[model samples]
Each structure stands twice: as C-alpha cells, then as structure tokens.
Target: MPSKYRNFRSSVPWIILFLEVVLIILFYFLFSDDDDASGSTNSYPAFQDVNHMVIFGFGFFLTFLKRYGFSSTGFNLLIIVLGVQCSVLIEDLLVLLLQREYKDGLQRITKAAVSMTAVVISTGAVLGKANPVQLILMAVVEIIAFHMSRSINTTFLQVSDNISMMHVHLFGAYFGLAVSSHFSEPSPRTEKNASTPKSDLLSMLGTLFLWVFWPSFNSVLLVEEKTKAIYNTYFALAVSAVTAFVLSLLTAKDGKFRMTDIHSAVLAGGVTVGYAAHIIEYPWIAMILGLLASGTAVLGSYCLQRCLHPALKIHDTSGIHFTFGLPGVLGALAQVVLLVLKDWTKSPRLDYLVMIPIGAFCLTISVALITGFLTGVIVNLKLFKTIPVSKYFEDQFYWEFPHLAVGF
Candidate 1:
C-alpha cells in the first residue's frame, strides 16, 4: 500500500467520528419532539440484555484467532458504535419520510442495537481479512441495505418476522459471505488462523452470553406473547446445546467435542427458533426446530464449510454460513410451514401467509449479496489501505505487543 493511502486510511476513523458527532447533534435538535420524548420505558430491561449481547457477546465471540484477539474485540466494538449511529439515523429518516413521524428513546436505540447485531454477524465472516476502515464502511452500507430490505418486507410484502430472523441473521450471514467471496485469496494455512486454548475459552464465554440472553433478544420487540417467544427460545436453545455437543463428538474423527461447534452450533436454536417464536404454541414443535437447527449447523460446520472454500471460493472466517445462514433459512421455512398450517382456515388473505415470507426470504438474499459485493469492491479500491496476506490474521499489524519488547 502507498504511504498516501495509508495516511488517508488512518484519518478515516477521525473523519467518521467527527461526522457522527455532528449528525448526533443535528438529530437531537431536529427530531427531539414531544412524541419522541414520550416513548415508552417498558422496553428498557430487554434493551439492556440485547445491548449486552451486542457489545459483549459478539465482541468476545470473534476472539478465537490465536494472533488477532485485540483486533477481533476492538473491531467488533468499533463496528457496533458506528453501526448503531448509522442505523439510528437511517431508520429515523426512513420513518420520517414514509410515516411522517419521528421515533426516539429506548425503542429506537434497541432497534438500532438489533440492526447492529446483523453487522456484527457479517463482521464475523470477514473478521481477520479486513481493516478497521473497511469494516466501518461495510457497517454503514449494510445498515442502509438492512433498513431498505426491512421496509420492503414490512411495508410492501407485509411480512411479520417478530424477531427479525430473516432480516438480521439470514441477511447478515449471506452479506458477509458475499463480501468474503469477493475478498477471497488462495493462501496456505497460517498460525494466525489457528486458535489457542485460552482464546477458545474467551470465545466460549461470548457464546454463553449469547445463549443465556437469546430469549430476551427474540422477545424484546413483541407487544404481546413475549412469554411465549421467550419460552420457545429457551426450550429450543437448551435442546440445541445438547444436540450440538452430541453431534460434535459424533462428527469428530476422535469422537470428541469441538470448541467451534459448541461456540456456534449451540446457538443455532436461538437463530432458528426466532422466525416462528410467536406462532409455535407447542414445546414439542420448538424442540423439533431446535433439533433441525443444530443438525443443520453441525453438518454445515463439519461438511459444507470445507466444500464452500473449494467450490464457491467463499472463506467464511467464523462459519457464519452454517451458524446463521443455513439455520436462518431453516427458520424461515419453518415459519412458512407454521404460517400455512396455522392460518389456513382462519385468515382471509391466505396467499399472504405463503407469499410474504418466501418473498422476504428471496429479497433478503438478493439485497445482501448485491450490497455486500458492491461494498467489497469499494473496500478493495486503491483509495483504502490493503492488508498484506502475511498480516491477514495477525494482531501485530494493528495492535501494540509490549510484551515482545526487549527493554520491557
């Protein structure tokens, strides 16, 4: 990379931070009205749990790389901070333009946090490969695409995804994979890509946080049947965790559990169950979804991921394709089935029950792939600093290693 470009890249964060401050100031003055002030306080508790999942759960989860612990957690935090601001501005602008109203307080902040969740999942797909500036750029563009796709689903398609499974998990996974596909290079394995016992333990802590609070994530935005959503999520996650452990042992060559499988596959139930959380009235049904989700995730981790690199040239760093992508699609399909079965005789517009979810599913993929590819193109342009292949997963590229100093 040229020195000019390196200098420019270093200034990008400062520029963005300044712009965020300005935008936030403008937002407060321009959109701060009585309606915004009167936003409900009921959602605060759920907001706290979901916020924790975003900041801590996702931040630590990506620290599995042996040499990239600092960048993993640091970039996660940076992306979320940028993502939340951009999400809030875009969502509020969309609401004002379409509905002729303003939104604020815990409601919009919670929604922004949820939107950033998708960005974080996408970040997982390209974790060690991209620079901080590129990641920030990706978050801004992805947030815009997210709101657009969401509007299309809710307003035009009339889709009812109470937990945003399709819009968040499915979209995020595919988008990140698409970006990864664009950034893919054929390089031999390196120590930087490997994990240590300590790193894996830290990553497991993140997974545990996500698993415990996933019920809150699924039920946060619901006005009714919150208990049902929470119960279904908990039931599904419990089953998924047990299934993940058993399957990990079965799938391994030495018949032992893999930390990676436990890290992601155990949370498959949370992602898969959200699509139909409100509709599934039976615990057995939630358990079935859990079993299917864990199986799909474990198989994808064990089987499909290997094939993906060779076949499609997609190097999913965190295996988001299996954990979020495939399981999310399964959740969407499950919702389709429940929608048809449960609403077959009751609803007048039965066509919507089938068409909306399917359409939203297809639309989410199209938007994610297109936007992600475009973002990848922009990130790879000569204007930004390029990461050398040798430094791909090494924290020394971006972080200080004081312990390595002879004087120290």
Candidate 2:
C-alpha cells in the first residue's frame, strides 16, 4: 500500500503537467487565429479548424481508456465525448473573444445547454471496457482525415466552394469503430446483451437529436445559404430514415432491431449525405444518391471489418478520410456529372475532370503525408499516453484522478 500511495503521489503531478500541455496547445491555436500583428481585419480567423479539438480529444480519450485497459462503457464514452465538446466550446469562446467578435449570450447558452445535455445522456449509458490498440488507430485515422480535408480546401475550389469539411466527422466515426474492433476488447453487452427498455428509449432520442441537428453541425461555419441548407437537411433525413429502417430489419433479433446499429446508421447516413448536400438540389436525385452513398459506404465498412482489417492487421476507424473525405469529394464531382447529363445548354467537362485528379491527389497523398507526420510525432513523443491499461475502466483514473497518466 505504501508503494501504491507513492505511485499515486507521483501520478498527480504528471497528469497536471499533461493537462497544462493540452491547454497550452489549445490556447496557442486560439491566439494564433487572433494574431494580426499588422492589425488587419483581413487576417483569416486563426484556428478555423476548432473541430480538431473534438477529433483529437476523442481520439486521445480512446487512447487513454484503451492504454489503461478500461471498458468501453457507454457512460465512459459519453464523458469523453462531452469533455471534448466542452473543450471545443471553451476554445470557441476564447477565439470569439480574441477576435473581439460579438454574439448573443442566449445563442451561446442554447448551444452550451444542448451540448451539455447530450454529454449527460451519453454518460448515463456507460459500461466500461476499452481497447488501446483501437484508440491508437482512431487517433491515426482522424489525423489522416483532417489533413486530407485541409489539403482539399487548399487545392480545390474557391473558399466559397469548400465542402471537404463535412467529410471529416463522418469518416472519423466509421474508421474509429473499425480500429476499435480490431484492437479493443469486446463489450460485455455484445449482441446477446439485451437492451433495457430505458436504453432503447434513450437510443431513440439520441438518434433523433443527431438526425435533426446534423445539417446545422455540418454547415455551421460554412458560407450561409439557408434555402440550400434546408433542402439538404430534409433530403438527408429521408435517406437516413429509409436506410436505418432497412439495416435494422436486416439485423434484428427476435423481431427487435439491434439498437446500436440503428443509432450508428442514422448518424452515418446523415454524414454520407453531407458530402453532396450543398451541390445537389433535387430531392429525388438527392435521395437516390444518398441511399446509394449510405449503402455503399456501409457495405465498404462491413467489408473492411471482415476482410481488409483482418488480413492487413491495420485497425483503423478514422473513417473521416474514407467515408466523408473521399466519398464527399466524389459526391461533389458527381454534381458536375449530373449537370452534364441533365442540361443541354452548356458543358463543364473540363472543370469536372480537373476536380477528379485534384480531389484524388489531395485526399490520398497530401492528407496522408501531413496527418501521418503530425500523428507520428505526437505518438512517438508520447504526448497522449495514459496508464494501467486496466485501471482506466474504473472512473478514478479517467475522471476522478489526474495523476494516472503515462509514465507516472
């Protein structure tokens, strides 16, 4: 017990040190965004990619839980997700203040309220059992997806035309899940685990919330076009509903659908639609394409699970690059195709062809190089390491204690 106590004592300081480092990095990005040494309003807001906080944080949390051998409890996952979201909001506020931008307190509160509520709901669903391998894979995938998106933004299209951002979140979820399965331990409540009535109810509500707000989340900081956004939202909703219902039925046990797949599908379907939402206007065409996109991506994800992952030994759920980044780029290019086929007045063949090579180059090479390099640096430096591999399952390590970090 004395050794344990001494170990504990040393850990607290290390945890504090890690938190300080994370906070400092976050602030650096915030400060950089606000940087205008020449005092020009023209400085593009520093760190427009505040979404990285969640992607990285979520990846880190998974890594933390996995390295410590914790369970992937619903509640635990929820807490980590909430913490990441909170960090984003805090970062956002810092950015807003730094830029001297004014916004309504009510709007800010509303966002904060909903975000917090989501965290609470997710936390309530906890059941611990983490996989470190999976978590590491997740971090790797997210970094790749982010870099790919960044590359697309830089190389393809005018600032107003950038749509790659929507793909990162979508793909991240898929890739992360894949990686988790490969490296993480199985949840105790596997398919055989019965869903409590309460769990089912909560899952239903959570699905609805994500479905409704998905469009807002996707287009939040994009150039505003309310009419286009609304059309895209409904189109996405219809496709997601149809796909979720079908997948649920196909995977049901005793006539009751597997709620996990249902919830994940809704989110995935919404994200799949995000890629082409801005460019596609016709509802029917959007629905047809959305369904195709959802089905194909899901099928690809399933195949990745059984064949590619097992054979290659590459556990990755950083679906951001795969699901959204690549698919969305294709979706955008598809828009150009639709126009060519549907209209007789003019041809955009040259522009459309140009996008194909450009999108491919950006997603495959640029994202891989940039994101891979950064993630490798972080992992090699052990910037996001944690301890015990098993202790993390207990709330004490992840939430209650600060000292259980790696090397402590």
Candidate 3:
C-alpha cells in the first residue's frame, strides 16, 4: 500500500480497496447505457434489504466465535464488498451473452447483492481459518462459480422460482463445506474457537436482522406475488424461530440448550421456504416448511457436529453442512415437489415440470462440489497455503487488535 493510503496501525489491504473502486466505476459507466435508461427507483427498498443481508447479516452471523470476531466481521466486510463489485461485471457479461437486459445500475446492484450473499455463506464455512488474501481469492472464485451455476439454472435449465434455494444457499453451502473439508484440521475447540457472551449476543442480533428482513429478501424479484411472498416468508420465519428454540433443548442431551440451535436452526425458515415463498399461496405450507426445515437442520447439526465429523475426521468449524447444506437440500427438494404439484393442478403432464428443478438441483450440487473442491485444492497448494495451524482461528495474526493488541 502507498504511504498516503496506509492507516499506520491497521492493515487495510489498500490494493484490494483500490481495485474495488475501479470495479464499481466500470460497472456503472461500462455495462449500462445512457440511451436506454431503463430502471425503476421502486426497487430501491429491496436493494436495501439485499445490502443489509450481505453487509450486516452475513458479517454478524459469522461472529459467533470468541476471538475470531474481528476476522469474522472485518474480513467479511472486505470480501463481500469485493464480491459485489466484481459480480456486476461478471453477471452483466453473462447477461449480454444471453442477450438479456437489466433496468439500471440500482437493479444491477441488487443482483450483485445476491451474488455477495452467496459468497458470504461460503466464507462462513471456512471462517477464521483463511487470511484476507485467501478470502479475497475465495470470494472471487466462488462468485464466478455461483454465477455459472445460477446462470445455467435460470437459462438453460429453466428452473423458475426459488432462485435462492438453488443458486445462493445450496451452491454457497456445499462450496464452502467442500473447501473447508480440505483446509487444515480444526485446532482443538479451545477458547480459540469458543464464543463469549458478548459474541453470542452479536450472533443473535445478526439472526434477528436476517429473520426480520428475510421476507423482503425473498420477495425482492416478485412481480405480482410480492404480498404472498412477504406473508409466507414472514410466517415461515416465525414458525422456524419458535421451533428452533424448542427443539434446541428437546434434542440435546440432558435437555440443555445448545448454541448451535441459536446460531443456525432459527433461520431455517428463510432457507427452506425461500424458493416457493412467493409461489405458495397458503401459509400452512409455509408453516410446515419452517417446522420441518428447522427441526431437520438442528438434528443434522447435532449429528454432523457430534457424530459424523468425529467418525469421518472431517473438519467443519461452524457446522455449515447442517445450517446451510441440509436446509438448502430440503428447500430445493420441496421446491421441485411444489413446482410439480402446481403444474399438476394446471396441466396434465408432470414429467417435464418435475424433471427441470431436479436436474438443476443435481447439476448445481455437482458443479458446486467439484468446483469448490478444486478451489480448496488450489488454495491448499504451496502457492496459497493457509496460516499456521496454531494460529488458525485467532485474528491477532491478521488484524491489529484494540488496547495495544500487539504488545498484549
């Protein structure tokens, strides 16, 4: 970094910031046109919702660790901004190849927002272990992979509705898990990975923020069904939150509550019903999804966090496999089933409608898994090796902590 840009004490990674500025300038001046001038300022509210999800939701959601708060939130801030900045260029290029049109810079920004949401989820899976540079690399590669899979699903596969189910959640979850699986093993779950009361409070705040705004998150692109989307997503989120609270104790040994439930299960509603949040006309369906999704996610978290990882020797820090992966799968499957059911009510043939989402699901999982694994392998190569094992989850190595962080 140049002397002028340096913060003296804090390591700002100014080069990345400079690149971000250049990318934002290019997105507006380059991809958009003065002649067409098509866009709706009406979409600004939804744009804000997406921005919060990326900037605040993902950042705090990963801040559940005690010592990793700085890395979790700071690195998140850095990578997501970069992800969104780069996504505009990448998504616009994909759209042009398909001869599609976008309204304006604001709408393009919302699209970029969802792209960042996907990248942040992947970052959560590999949280606390990756350096800022590695995370930047991960964000760039994951954004490209997310776009390719999402573009294919929307275009060639014609999988309509539940865009987040297949594109954002499933791809991000699996990709991050695949990457984390190859990263160095977890250091013992010491204070290094543990959360303090303050951190838990921060995590809850993130959870509530995501829970409250999720209705808007899923409803952003709804043309005529915005109200239905809002109602279903809202109801589903409520049901899931209550269910996660109850089941967190019921499922735990000695009937004690677990932090994992608070961290992951409560938000299953947003994930499980996301695809059909607008499509489903009934609140009952939404409630059923929330109940089932959160319940299943917690149980999966229990198994993966306790049994499966111990048995298999795979390292997952935040239990991404359950929180994101299981819910994503359930949501995608439910969406496909609903799509077919909706088609059956209107049309005679079920085969064609059923196969499309199923195929997209299969294709997306394969692409995410393969691409994610390869990305992980590349990062693990000598060229991009991660930090030392002893220093895996702590942030003092990367960031200058407060109150004389270095001398302490």
Please name the candidate that would achieve the greatest lDDT relative to the true structure. Answer: 1
**Worst 10-residue lDDT window, candidate 3:** 1-10
Q: What would the C-alpha RMSD of candidate 1 be, to one decimal place?
A: 2.2
Tens-digit lDDT track of model 3 for 205-320: 88878887888888876778889989998888889988998998887788888776867988888888888887897899999999998888888876787888777666777777
Off by over 4 Å in 1: 1-9, 28-30, 33-39, 161-166
Residue 285, model 1: Cα distance from true site in angstroms = 0.5
- lDDT score, candidate 1: 0.85
lDDT of 1 by residue, 1-408 (tens): 468546865787686778689778867854543444334566678889999999999988889998889998988988898788778778777877787455546777888999888899999988899988888888989999998999888888777645343469988998998888777563765667789999999999999999999999998878788899999999999999999999989988998889988888999998999988888999989998999999999988767766766688788888898999999999989999998999899999988678878888899999999999998899888666767676688887777788888765
Clashing pairs in 1: none
Ranking by TM-score: 1, 3, 2
What's the lDDT for all of these models?
0.85, 0.44, 0.79
